[model samples]
Each structure stands twice: as structure tokens, then as C-alpha cells.
Target: MIPKYNLVLCTLLALALAACQTPWVRDAQPRAGDAAPAVAEHPTATPEPETKTTPPTPAAPEARIEPAPPPDLWTRLRAGFTLPTRLDDRRVQLHLQWFKRHPHYLSRVVERAEPYLPWILDRIEQAGVPTEIALLPIVESGFNPFAYSHGRAAGLWQFIPATGRRFGLEQNWWYDGRRDWVAATDAALAYLQANHARFDGDWLLSLAAYNAGEGNVLKAQRRNRARNRATDFWSLDLPRETEKYVPKLLALREVFTHPADYGLELPPLDPDQRLELVETGGQLDLALAAELAGLPLETLYRLNPGFNRWATPPDGPHRLVLPHGASARFSQALAELPEAQRVQWQRHRVAAGDTLIGLASQYHTTVALLQEVNQLRDHRIRQGDHLLIPTARESLERYSLSAGQRKLALQNRKRAGNRQVHVVRAGDSFWDLARRYKVGVRELAGWNSMAPTDTLRVGQKLVVWTQTPAAANPNIALQRVRYRVRQGDSLARISQRFKVSIRDLEQWNDLDRRRYLQPGQVLTLYVDVTRQAGNG
Candidate 1:
């Protein structure tokens, strides 16, 4: 304020102070040890925006859980058992002791039952009977489909021929429905249900009736009522076999219920491994069926023991039970096969001495069947006439479980005596054979694996277990020869050429007499070589 230069200095100080207050000048000014700030070419450029972050939420606990798979068949069977397991009767205890002593008997039976048990259980459940009924087969036939009892009962249910027929089971040359598990099971369950109703829902009485006929059981009850005795199953006077039968079933139930307690290890069966019945649509040869199913012939026979021959019955029931896996293959293959190809056929020319009876015996067929096939009014047939015959495609021996094969096997089984083969003549009977062989009729029939009631066919072969060797007739020197049939062959021609009777050929080869001989078909002949040499 005192001098002009002083005034200029004051003005500069004021300007500098004012410049320090300006943000652009202050920010532009640099500090020690710091780099200079970058000058913005475009001062009005927009700044970048900040982003906010979010934390993740946790997952909820699992809400649904799957149920555990059902237990094995044995466990399920035990759980479903509804029989009276608390029987204190001595008969039941006796059987229980027997079972405990012979554990392997049950083991073997269970092994055989594996293929059948699941289906049986399903049927039993559906039938609404006590699950214990499934064990009845164990007592009856040991669950054997091929079981033929001394009492003429057959199959797992052990139905006699009469009972089988009453239950609509057919017994024929081609099939025995008594041996069919499916048919027999249905028949047996139906019979049991009927008995159950008849006996006023008494399962024990019904079971006893099954062993001894319902008529017998009713008669026993009637007698008990007359005597003023308790008419319970235990109180009634039943057959000895029937008395043991009901208790045997109950003991099996107890053991099966607590197998571990009895120290029994039931055979392990996969519940899922099961059999299914598939319809074959028509008469199908068992050999071809087995081939189509990719199964062994023996396996097919075991599963379907109903069939008695190489082919199923021509009339009906054209069904086969196969493993679940093989059903599709078999059904498809069967659908494509022609009906003409279902059975093998052969043509035969009638020769001299070719009577219908002789031809039927030779080809293992019936006179009626021959007449039907040949369109003959009478048993008469002219020489040099051609006839068509149905024949097995495979060799007879290949049908290991066929009726003839089974009989052959039984006959060939070694016993404790000198084995003699007797060719049955027209007049032969069980009584006649028993007298000739110096053996009981029952024993002779049994030796041949036949019931005394079974008919003896002419030219049938019977095995005699004799204490002494059979005397050889000088006129009948015999030799076994396997001869293959040639074209234009006939039973009469073969018989004459070989110097053997047609009956002998039939017996030796198990030939069906009504069928024609095929070219290249092998025939077993018991040729009289001595007679042949004499004739030559």
C-alpha cells in the first residue's frame, strides 16, 4: 500500500493463494517422488460403473427314497406260510425227526424243485390256499414230474389215472397230462379246493382226502360219528398212508418255516429265474422245437415231461414250456415253419405178406391209424402199393426220455439175477409170463418197469430176472444187426430178406408199425443168422 512495487508483490501473493484453492491447478501440481498425473485429452469422458456381487444359496435335502427290493423266494414263502405250525401230534413229530435225520433228501428235492417253485408259489397264492400246499408235492412225488408210483399215481401231484381223468387230465399215447406240471398243478389245486369245501374248510381233512380218496375220508367220518368219537382228522380211522401223509406235510411246513433251527440249508433258488409257457400253435416235433429253442433235447424233455413221444399230440394242446430267454426264439422259429415240415414222413411200398396188422406192428402205429392214412376200407392192402407214414426226424435213441427209451433204459438197468429177454407172443399175459418165468406176476411186471395192470402187446420185449440161464432153442439162432433202410424198402421185404419176423424187427427197433420206413432210416433187427444162412 506504501509503494507501487510493494502493491504489485501483494497482488501476485493474492493471485497465488487464489490459484492453490482451484482444484484443477492443485491436481495438476506434482509431489516429490510421485509421477505426474496424465492430462485427459477429453476431460468430459464418462467414468466406469461399479458392479455388486451376490452370494449363492444352499441346496435342500433329498426328499424321496426308493424302497428296498423284496426278499428271495424262500423268505417270501416263509412269510406267506399260513398253516397250523403248532401241531403237537406224535405223527407230526415222527415225521419231523425223519426229516432232521435225512437232510439230503430235502436238499435233493429242493434242487429238483428250483425250476418249478416260483410258478407253483404264484399259482398257490392265486388259488387262495395256504402256502403250505406248495409243499404237498414234496410229500407226494418229491416234486418229480416223471414220478410213477407203485399205486399208479403219476407226476408231482401223484394223481392216479382215474383222478387225472376226473380232473380233465388226458392220458394218451402221445402225452400224459398227469406228468404236466402246469396241468397237474391246476388240477391238483382245484381238487384240493373242492375237498376243502366238502370237508367244511378242514384243511387237514382235505389233505387226508387227497391221499386217501374223499369217499374214504367221508366214510371214516361217518363211522366216527356213529361211534360217538371225535371226527377230527386225528380221530378218524384213515389209511396208514393217509395218516402219515397229513403229518408229513405239516412237518415239512415246520422245517421250512425254521430251516436254520433244524440245521437244514434250503437250496438257493433265484426267484427271477422262471419258466414261461409258450404255445406252439400246432403239432410240433419236440426235436425241432428243442433245436429252435437253442436247448438240449434232454433239457426240453425235463421241462415238458408231458410229451410221451418225439412229437407233441397232433390234435391239440400245442404248447411248450421253455426258459424265459428261449421263448422268443422258439415262437419266431415255429411261426415260420410249414405244417408239412412239422413231422418227418416216409413212403413205403407194400410187399408180399404185408398185412395191415403186420405193417402196423412193424411201424409202431395202430391198424386204425394205418387205415386212416392209407384210405383203406378194410385191413386189406394190395402188394406194390405205396403208403405215406409220419416218422420221427431224429433217431429213436436221440429221444432219450421218450416212452420207448425210458422203458429200454429201465429194462437195461442191472438187477441181481440173470437177465433174459422174452419176446411176447400173441397169447402172452402177465400171469402167463409169471408162470413161465417162475416169478410172481407183480415181480415180473415190476422187473419190466410196468404195473401188473398194464397190457402186454404182442411182440413186446419183457426182461426176466431168472435164477437159471434160459435154454436156447436150436431153431432160433439170433444175432442183432443195425440195418439202414434203402429206397423201396418195406417191413415185409426186410423181414423176408433178413429171415426174421416183422414182430422181431418191431421189438428190436421200437418201430412204430403203422409208419412207413424211410430210406436211410436205421432199423435194429434180431436176425436169425442161422436161418438166413440156411435160406441162402
Candidate 2:
């Protein structure tokens, strides 16, 4: 019985050890049929990325970025049109090549003239023309306001005088709207609009017409059409200058459009550069306007390109352009200058190839007088330069009975110490002349002795002034200085000591004092530096 008990105990111990070794048998486990319920929230769990199932390839990262928005409908439509930007060398070489020789002309233009980019851009945009067209000026006249083509085109926009007049541009001796910034801008825009309408809104053709005239462009188109060739500017056989004219404008446009692409650094335009057009009823000074408006004088000069002088005329509707913020002040100040001081004036912008003399001829003023009044010491006024001019008044009444109006006036005036005469131009008449010269018809007749029925011929000179032209005889006189004689000098010794003439000493010095011959007596002498240098 004891042996059986020991065997049973050992068996029981062995069973316990086996149960310990297989712990899975005692612990709870998840069965496939009874899996643990999934939790709704778990701190340690991470969600999968909510993106495209497959990522983009390494080669095209940009593919993931959205492309730039398409240009608006207007932009797309405008892109179809192109204006003259530059000359096509193969199609036309003469004028284009000739102008290219003066490559620095453009740079010089930008330097002297106030930047018209702001005002010009605004006006072009207003006319529905692209801002790119502003660059067309570089090709037209190299941005010269006074550029005159062999074809008779003038102004920055190259409007012919007649065409400029047709567009209501003023063409008087006092003012040529062709050179007036505001008026020329309006005329050019109108002409361009007309050309565009005539060409059915084909800007390129309109531009071509503008350069070569509508008649020439129409002829070219008809010729090309008859030959079954394209009517595009590229195919038309335009004049040499006209052919390259478009291309030159395009080259400038290309440069302006993507300056960075061409490695050119264009300063970003300032917002303040924008201008607002306002009319003036009377004269105003630019300096005063600039001060009232808190603007720089250079800025005013740029903003108002019409005034050819420093002061705006007080005459009716002088048409002054003030800064964006100063129109009110300008008008108020215009009311302040004396009414008599208010002279009729028109503004003119300086153009390339223009000199003080050329401007004087245009305005009917002497260059010397222009310089004298404007305080200009130099002859280098530039394109886009502005000037103020005092309108010419009519001649005096006494000069109406003379035969050779100019000669009679001059003779009468020379007899009366009159000195200068100016020729009557295309738009001059007795009334305009009288007002311009500030003389009545009778005074003019008395001055020049002109007959009442004698019509002034083109290029015929008329007496303009009663004073002898100072320019005719310059005031070239020596300066005189007086000095007191000292105790140690004799008359001959004093003459030799100061290197002066005895005769001049006698003439300049007091003879009575010389007779007194006292020490420390004052003596006067004339020393002509020019004469002294000549003697030396």
C-alpha cells in the first residue's frame, strides 16, 4: 500500500510540471471565431495618408503644381494684334540701318526728357491701345517731340502738321499742337483710332498706315491682294523707312515687355507717377505749382510738357497740366497773378533734333531773348523738354501804309530806333500779328509804313520791335575802376606803374584833381581786359 501511495504522488507532481510548461493552456487567448472588438479611438494608432494612391515620379515635381491661369479674353484678343516695334532688316534696310547708327539716341532721349511712361501709359490705356505701344515713340522719333521726317511727319507721335491740325491741334507761332504733349497725345490717339477703324481694327495695319499714311497702306494692301500675297505688314512692300519702322517699334516693345529676359533692369514704375489731367483757365508758375503741391520742380516740368517757358500764361485756357495733387492749388494761384500779366500762351514739348534757335523760329522769339527770359545759360534743351511762351501780340497802328512791310517797318523803326523784325508764317494775319506784337494796326503802320491792302507774304518780314535789336550790336565795353594816387607816384610813373594809358588816365581821372596834384588824390582808369590782352 505504501509503494502505491509514493507512485501516485510522483505522478501528480509530473502532471503539475507539465501544466506549468504549457502556459497557453491556462491563459485566455483570442480565437479566430471570437476576435477582440476593434476600438474606435486608440492613442498609439496612426492613420494612412489621404492622398493619391501613387506619388508623382521624381522627374517631374512641377507636374504637381498648377499651371498659370490662362490670360483673360481681352488679353488673348489683344495679343492677336501687333504694332510697329522695329524695322525688318531684310525687307527694308536703308532707313532702319541709318537710324540704328545712332543707337545711343534712345539712351540720350531717356536721360534728358522727363519719363512720360506714367502719363503716356494711362492715355494709351484709355484709348484701348496697349501700353506696349508707348514704346513706339522710340522708333517714331526716338521719342522726339520735334522730329520732322522727310515725309513731313512731326512730333513725338510723328503727326504731319496738316493732320495734326485736322485733329484740332493748334498750329500758331505761339504754339504748335504737334509739339504740345497733351494736344499731340490726343491727336495721335484720334488718328490712330481713325486708322484702326479704317483697317477694321487691324492694329498692325493701322500702325503701318500711321507710319506710311492710310493712302499708302491701302495702296500696299491692294497691291498685295492683287498679287495674291498676304496683306500682312511683313509681306507689304512699304517705303524703306516705313518698312523697318514697325520692326523698330517691335524691338522696343520686346525689350520693354520682358526686360528681365533681355537682362535689362527697368526700375519699377512708382504709383505716384500717375497723372490726372486738369484744365487751367489762366497762367500759373510751375515753381509755384510744385511748391503748392509739394512736388519737385523737375517733376512739374515733366508733368506739364506744354508750357514752353517757366511760367504758364494767364490767358484763357492756357491748358496747363499740374501734378496729381496740385490742380486745385494751380487754379487758385492762376487767379492770383495780375490780369495784365496773364498772357496767352500755349505749351510745347521739346523734341529731338531741336535747338534753341529752331525753337525760337518755331515760337517766333529770338534765341537770345528766350535764353534771357528763361535764364538758360546753355543751348542743350532736350526732347520732351517743356517750354512756356508769351503769346505774340499785334503790331502798333501806325505801320499800315508801308509798301515793303518789313523794310518800311524797319526803316521807320530804325529811324525811331527800332531794331527787330520777324517774318509772317503760314497762320499769321493782321489781327493775330497785332495781338502778338502788342501793337495796333495804325501803330504797326506808323512803325513799318505798310499799306492797308498789302497782304503779308509767307517768309515776308515784318517789323516786330521799335528798339534796335541788342543782338545786332553786343554791349562790349571795358570796365572802369578808380584808385587814389599815393604819395610816391609821378603822373608818368603812375601811368607806367599801373600799365595804363596816359590818355585813358586823363580821360577817366578828374583833370581838376590832376592839376591839384595832391597826395592820396583819387584817379579813375579804364581797363579793357580784352584790349589789354590784345595789346599784350
Candidate 3:
């Protein structure tokens, strides 16, 4: 287990991939355990009777182990193997060549998957599916539940929004069931099963259908049938990606089934690195959950990757995963905590000009979370809308970063070593600073060792990192000049003329999306007279 520490606020201390769960204040964090005097059940032992004639001594009671393996994930996975080992196909061999060259990627993915592999493989076994299906995540998302594709598929299984909803995976602002391993795995298996049956029990065809929807597969199959061609997966014309998807899985299966053949070494699984599921009585903040579990909040977030917010969802599945070591203590402490105190909240009333993004910044939370907690269907909220915002909690050590993310962070630091300085003005805020620099609010906060919700005084200087220096950046020469509305005036035209984003124009002038512009009406415009090449 990773050692826990009472951490301090610093640039390096951050929950990677987590935007809102950043540390607030964590000085002298409380420990999970407290001792009390034990009460005596019995004062003394009774004398034994000498009635039995030479009664044999009873054997020591054998330690009872709950019916499970020794918590070895690798052994468990291998034992549940149900997939065929035959692999002489041309496509599979080609994929093996690529994988052999990039063995490090495989090792890193396997390591990241350690926290959930045992549970996932167990479920696949109970479903009577081949253990090879367990490696499907490697092909889809590298076992990262937060993985999102440019194609709009998300989660480990990479379910698209429509497909996820069809499988009963909720996609509300609060939670994305697509990222829930328990839900997504089940849904993926069900879809695969349906596809298998539809394709007459052909596993290869089923995998192809999983990549490209079953409808698409059916359409291709129909074309093959019309032409009286062979109806097998390889014979039919399919999407290019689907054609390789099955081969990728087969290649992974070959390596896992015979690692030594490819000269790759698989590490022994840690028995203590086991996941434990706990029933949260209700929605609970993960900061408190980590404290009670005697572990880092990042570990909790990793175990419960499906939880998008700092806390569990308000509706159902009031459960979260913890390290097996800390599960008992966390569950016990949670039971004793008051329901109202599970998450510290502040009531807010929306003003006439209040925006969700602005309000979220003021509250040190995300706009999506605000929408989720209030169950708002859209961004539109009327004035005086009562909002309950979760207050930030102090944190200790940051969640461990994935190897890839760590490398990227290092690369960014090296690139951002030379930065531009931005001074806070009369109308400056965290949101404005990020927008003006084209960086996220969290990135700005981390750069300065401050939280997004921290207050900034006028004349406070912030170090802003850019690809180019401030003197060379054309945007730095932006001048706030007034432009009069003409007969053919439009926000898009004005934005193009000034080389500014339409969103920035709307924000700067506070104009509604469909508001009309009258001729001769004056508008504020920030333009750059000095144009520079290769500037963002």
C-alpha cells in the first residue's frame, strides 16, 4: 500500500484528471481511528468440572477463510481462462508484431488495471464468458475508465451516449454510467451476447459488431448474402476499424496466454491490492470517505472511477469502492456520521446576471456538477433559483497519476518554464484570466499553487504560460476599442474582423444569443493591430 501523508498545499499536490476534487485545506488531517476503554464481559473464569473420563483435548479451531482465492489477481484471471488458444491467423500475427514493439504500453496499462482486474475477471467468469473478454478493455480504453474517444465513446468499454442509454447507463450531469465498470461491463457483455446470437454464435462476428454497431454489421451481412458470398466475418465488408478491432483482441489474448513466447514478463499480483465495495448510506463526499478509509482520496477516486463528482450520486447505487484494507474502517465511520454532514453545502440564490459558469467559479466547483446537484435539464436557470453547492474539503496526498499523464505533465512543465505574467485588473476573475489565455481554470490555479475558488486581489500578478512569449503574442497587443454597429453587422462578422472568438464577444458585452443589433449602436471590441505569426 502507498504510504499516507498529511500533505501541504503545493504545485505538485493535485488530483490528476480530477478538476473539482482539488485540495483546499488539509493541515493536521484527522486519523481514522480513536481508542476507548474496553468494558469487561466477564470478571473471572469458572472452574472446570472433572466429570468426563479422560476427555481428549479438542483440536485448535482452524482459521476460517471466506471462500475466495488468496487475492492473486493474475492467478485468478488465468484460472478463469475460457478462450481458445489457437492463434495462427495473418491479422493476429500482424497485430502481434506491433504489440511486441510497444511492450511498455502493455505493461503500463496492465499496472493501471491492477485495482479492478480481479473484480472484472470474476464477473466475466460468473457470466460464463471467456476470460479473453476481460482484455477487451485494453483494446477499447487501456482500462482507463475516464478514457474518452474523439468518436464520442467513453469509459473502459467505450460506449457511445446513445448506446449507453439503451443499456440503462445514466448520462446525467451527476454521473456517467458508461464509466461504471459494473454497469458498462454488464452492458457490453449483454450486447456481445445479443450480437453473438444474431451472428449465429460467431464470436469474431460479435466482436466486429461491438466495434461497429450491430445494425452496421447486419447491413454488411445483407450485402454479402445478396451477392451469395461467404457469410463469415472476414469475408464480409466491414468498417476499417472493426476489421482490426477483433485482430487486436486476438493479439492481446495470444500474449496473455503465452507471455514468455513474446519475451514479456508479467508481474506477480499484490494480495493486499484488493478492491472492497462499501454501501454508502447516501451521497457522500469522497474527501471524507478517503479520511475514514485511512487512504488517499485519489485511490478512492481510482477505485470508484464512475463517480464524476467529489461525492456519490444522490439517487441510487449508494455504494463506493475502497481499498480492501480500509473498507472496514471507512464503512464503520460512515455509519456514525450524520446524514446532513456527509457533504458540506452552501445555499446560493441566483442573481439577475448570474451564469452557471461564473457561479461555479465563485463556489469552487464545476458547472456540470452544479447542474447535476440541482437536476437542471439545461444551462438555463431563472433568477432566484436556489442552489446547493458543495464546499471544498481539505486533502492530503494527491492521487497517483498514470504513467502517461505524469510524463505529459513533465513535458508541459518543461515547455511552460518560460511564461508570461498577467496582472489582475478591476474586472478580473479566474474565468476571465483562463479565457483570455485560452487555458482551463484548474490549470491556472495549479500554476500558482492556489485553488480555482481562491480570491484574487487587484494588482495580484499571475504567471501565465503560453506557447510564445507575451511580447511576441499578437493577442497581448489587443486594444479595447469601440465599434459602431453597421447595416450588415453580425457577431460572427465582427468576431472574424477582430480575430476573436464569438463566445468572448458574447461574454464581454453580455449580449443574448439571439439579441438583435441596431444600426449605429456602439459595441466594445478588443482588437490587435500587430499581427504575429505562429501565435495562439
Best by lDDT: 1
lDDT of 1 by residue, 152-212 (tens): 7888999999999999999987889999999999999999999999999989999999999
In candidate 3, what are the lDDT values of residues 172-288, reduced to their tens digit?
A: 645688888878888998888888888898888888889999888899989989999987877889988998888888888878877776666788867686677789878777778
Candidate 2 local lDDT, 278-375, one digit each (tens):
66555544455556566676566545544444455333235656655566765676567666544445577875435566566656555665666666
Backbone clashes, candidate 2: 70
Cα error, residue 363 of model 1, in Å, equals 3.3
RMSD of each: 15.9, 22.6, 21.7
By lDDT, the candidates rank as 1, 3, 2
Off by over 4 Å in 3: 1-86, 347-357, 364-388, 395-536
Q: For all candidates, what are the clash counts?
A: 8, 70, 0
* lDDT score of residue 412 within candidate 3: 49
Q: Which candidate model has the greater lDDT, 1 or 3?
A: 1
Question: What lDDT score goes with residue 439 in model 1?
Answer: 83
